[model samples]
Target: MPSFLRWIACRAMLAACLAGIAASARAGCEPLTEDGHDYVACRFDPRSDALSLYWRGADGMPLATTERLADAVAATGRKLVFAMNAGMYDTALAPIGLYVENGRMLHRANLRNGAGNFHLKPNGVFYFGDGKAGVMETGRFLKARLNPAFATQSGPMLVIDGQIHPKLQPDGASEKVRNGVGVRDDGTVVFAISTEPVSFYAFARLFRDRLGTQNALFLDGSISTLYAPPLPPVGGWRSLGPMLGVTAGP
Candidate 1:
């Protein structure tokens, strides 16, 4: 065989071996802290339906709200945790959780434009704001713009993150209930089709299946924000409304 070809093969083999070792090391330990409040924290159990809900804390730690939570699982060492900003009472109410202001809930659409929208849709991320809503074709349209390694053209079926979910489609227009994800009666995660100007609950759900969630409830929606390292993996986090949190090194 040609020397160049042999050398190329050797490099490929070495890369594969390193990846295997890394995967094994990552799998070594998956710890979910118990007791004490975590600035960044999340929970999942073998018995449960691959559930995941993560958030940052006001104590100045990582939080998870608007961003997709599954990516955190693939990240090594970092953990996804959840918290509620009871301080922000009522800001706005989406199809899911209540929006809050200054730790108090408030629901005034005119307050902010991009306040309640998720950019990515199953097809692609659409534009939503300025008394206008954005639209995209589908995954095919978004594939080019999204990170190949992290983003998928199509969303997961069955269960989104371990909870039973329903197949959702976008309801674009003033009926901007465009982004939608579902949960099962037994508590499974179902994702909504991606849409431009994403909606809250676009990739979120809560199920009653897990013992921990007897009466599963949805946390935050578009106002939700997640803070983990290597920013801009899937979506970016903005300082919107109140953020429920659990963090690290706090």
Candidate 2:
């Protein structure tokens, strides 16, 4: 074969391979049904994508909706690709536990016991810093003493170190719209939300068994929602506290 022809063939193959990779990276949320429930699972490579947390705007009020966030990012010449409520909040729409955005701590970690899911023991923190992402028990995270650029603390870890939370019953009666985040083996970030009511055990399995994430943290329930391209708008009665979003690079 001619050397020129061989070089052209090699270039074509390289281009095709690059196109395939781009297609996989662009694959976002998709419907996933399991255990008689509906869910939307979105996957992104954290190592390559830009992930950040948002709460208040210049006005010192929670952005609340994705539309507001989109507009805010647009003003900065960036595009918000996706976003979701990051954790539970109080009546005032403030994060109930640890909340950090852009390397600033907004709320300290909560370790006290109380009513509701946030108090559930073994709660954990989902965080990213130093170009890596992780989910660890709140106590373990505190003990490690590592500071993260973005962090959100929430309760009753769904999957811990490759094992589902012991407190999560296999067939519990209690169920609600739930959402959470997990980190895969390759450091990819996987976010999932139940479109229909689902038990904690089932939701955890989605992350552990299906998404292949060894450690996963529950973000919130009932008020859980996601905003991304091609997904219909989600209306809520109250404002959201902390939110996790992926944005386009400058």
Candidate 3:
């Protein structure tokens, strides 16, 4: 081939490669409804989208709201794209179970059983590092002894190894606003929250059936909320504990 023709072909290939990368990195949220309940579902590529866990601010207090987190991230020259309350917490806005951020372990994993969702047996941790993400039962996580760059321990895994939690009932009377995270087969991280109250069984189905995730961990309920852009901010009276957020790439 002529030199001129070879140069044009090389440029075309480079352009195509760049386009594929952009498509894989795209992230956003959308409204969804299931089982008569409303929800907001956001999908992101863990390998590309910038995912981070945040707790305390520079003032040594939890960044309770999305606005505060956004400002903090903005100061670092990156825009906060979306955020959601992650894991269960105590009255003082501290994570009830294991919480790790940027290699720092703020809280230790709780293995005992007690009241509330956090203590729900078989509670799991959602963790990510080295361009990979996953959800594992707390017991399994402890056994593996893997150290992640970011992690949050939350409970009563909605979907465990492709099976729904044994305690969840199809017609359970309990229902409340809930949010959770799941990793798809292709390494996409999906964050979903019920805009309206929903039962644990129903919410679990959303991850296993709708999202096709084999493992999903419930983040929180009642006060579960999300902060996705373009849609008005969602907030609650209770202050958040640990938060998971996605920020604009550098």
Candidate 4:
């Protein structure tokens, strides 16, 4: 073989080897962060292979989905109050959206924060919802089997056996993503990033599969933001959007 051809072959083999190594490393274990919060920013680990929940904080900051509850917890020192959407909004039962109400899943009033009569809230549990029984719902199919209930909505979703479950997919599809933030009854907030406008059906399915919650809903995406500390300019921890996430601690 010619010297030039031999060299080219060697380089191709090297590139192939590098690519394989990179892929292996990427799949070794789930990615996570621990700047302060108790969960990974954008990764979910599920107990069963059926569904799971995943999240990724800003590059260097935590997403501020629950800023309201976190602040209240630090200030008043009381059991907070929140509302839920369960992945359905409009009067027509259009996928669940967020609304703040205390004691009920679809409360729509928070005069202090200017969220009144609106179908959405700023900070609440953001996850997939069944769109059937509002918050505190069970999967359409899995209700008798896996019976999964989420504390919030912070991951994509999945649908199995004609039922919804909280699940995550790294490269699912553009239609499955929601460009918004979501609120849950328990106060968990999910900041979503979507390549396009997600709908009620798709959102519900993705939320169920990826996040393991049959009743996960959509949250503010695209313009969604996060904020955190110990930021780096060049590489390492960074926020997803312009908003900052500051955990309450002195």
After superposition on all CA atoms, what RMSD does each candidate show versus the true structure? Answer: 17.8, 3.6, 3.7, 16.0
Tens-digit lDDT track of model 3 for 1-250: 9999999999999999867654444365888777677888888887778889999899999899878898999999987888999889898999889999999898999888798887777899999987899999999998999999999999989999999999998988899989999998888899999888889999999999988899999999988878877766555534888889888746
lDDT of 3 at 95: 89
Tell me, by TM-score, which candidate is best.
Answer: 3
lDDT by residue (64-91, candidate 1, tens digit) is: 3434333343353443332222112223
Against the unseen true structure, what C-alpha lDDT does each candidate score? 0.29, 0.86, 0.87, 0.31
Count the clashes in each prediction.
Answer: 64, 0, 0, 74
Predicted structure 3, TM vs. truth: 0.89
Model 2 off-target regions past 4 Å?
1-27, 233-238
lDDT of 2: 0.86
Rank candidates, lDDT, best first. 3, 2, 4, 1
- Candidate 4, 60-104: lDDT as tens digits: 232324343234335644321211112323333222322322223
lDDT tens per residue, model 2, 1-250? 9999999999999999876655454447788887778888888876777778998888998888877888898989987878889998987889989998889998999999998788877999999966799999999999999899999999889999999999999978899989999998788889999888889999999999988999999999888878877676442425788788887746
lDDT of 3 at 39: 84
TM-score of 4: 0.27
